[model samples]
Target chain A: AQTVTQSQPEMSVQEAETVTLSCTYDTSENNYYLFWYKQPPSRQMILVIRQEAYKQQNATENRFSVNFQKAAKSFSLKISDSQLGDTAMYFCAFNVGSSNTGKLIFGQGTTLQVKP
Target chain B: GAGVSQSPSNKVTEKGKDVELRCDPISGHTALYWYRQSLGQGLEFLIYFQGNSAPDKSGLPSDRFSAERTGGSVSTLTIQRTQQEDSAVYLCASSLRGLYSYNEQFFGPGTRLTVL
Candidate 1:
């Protein structure tokens, strides 16, 4: 079984600053996918960024990027130029690559607050 | 459909009562999944349907919880004799089939179940 872990229960960042949320996972699967999702008070899970385990380069989506260390089994999300809108619960998720099933496991979310 | 959608955005039921939650996957998606998000915990995998076959159901917490997909589209998760511990947000997601595809699961606005 694969499990994801988020060490920080909550994080805060000043407006226009950067914040990094830590996540680690235990999985034997060689090939998999890592994802970061944001859930606003509206309770909608929004995709932030994703990284493929096979890719050596990290994934970057404008303001959101990930530091994926496959050997260490670590995948972290970095949010730059944080704005008030970035305040939400952030979750780190994982999934088996190309498996017949669509099972995405998530970590205990980190509530992020962007203070102005 | 525009996106994955779950019915009855919020459900409040008494203990020992039966509750049914519905999910409508996006049109053309061949894979659907169900997950439970506890108050402060991560999202737990429940079950999934891939073109009508669910090869893996090991994630289901108990036999009292069952889910089924019909016509490879809509799905329903039923909890017989719900317990207070069953209070959580039920999330549904849909994705395209095949191992080579991007395999990103689009989530729906979860149904919040509060067992009293």
Candidate 2:
């Protein structure tokens, strides 16, 4: 079984600043994918960034980046130059690469508040 | 191109009534998934469909929960005798391919179901 955990239930950041949301997972599979998703109050889930366990380099998408430590089983999301629009519930997810089902296991989520 | 779309963005139903939620995936997507998000919780995988393969119902919580995808483009999740515990946002996602492809799953604005 795989499980994802977001230790921070809530986090706040000032506009133009940066915020980091922590995530950790437990999986015995060596080949897998990690993802960060954002869900706003409107209840729309949007993909933020993704990382492959086989790749040593982390993934970065514009202002959003991830620090993926495969050995430590850690995959943290960093939002740089945060804006009010960045305020939302962020989730960390894991998917086994070999599984044909393509189902995702998600973390508890971190509610982010980007203050103006 | 339009992203995934779900109908009846918000649904309020009686505790004992049955509710049906719908999802329309992207035109060329070959994989679709259903997930549940309860208050202050992460998204829980419910079921998955890929092309014409057998749907994975392993994540379904109970027998009351069931889903079906028709014509490989649209899906319907039916909840029988809904309970308060079933009150949550149901999310749908679709991807270009499944399994080792590592395709990103695009999500739709979830249907928020409230059982009273």
The number of the candidate with the highest DockQ is 2
Off by over 4 Å in 1: B98-101
Regions of model 2 farther than 4 Å from truth:
none
lDDT agreement with native, every candidate: 0.89, 0.94
The TM-score values for the models, in the order shown, are 0.95, 0.98
Span of ten consecutive residues with least summed lDDT in model 1 chain A: A96-105
The sequence of per-residue lDDT tens digits that candidate 2 reaches over residues A8-62 is 9999999999999999999999999999999898888888999999999989999
Task: Put down candidate 1 lDDT per residue, B1-116, tens digits, no spaces.
Answer: 49889999999999999999999998998888888999999889888788856436777899999998888889999999999999999998888873433577888999999999
Q: What CA RMSD would you report for each candidate?
A: 1.4, 0.9
What 10-residue stretch in candidate 2 chain B is worst by lDDT? B96-105
**Residue B114 in candidate 2, Cα distance off native in Å:** 0.8
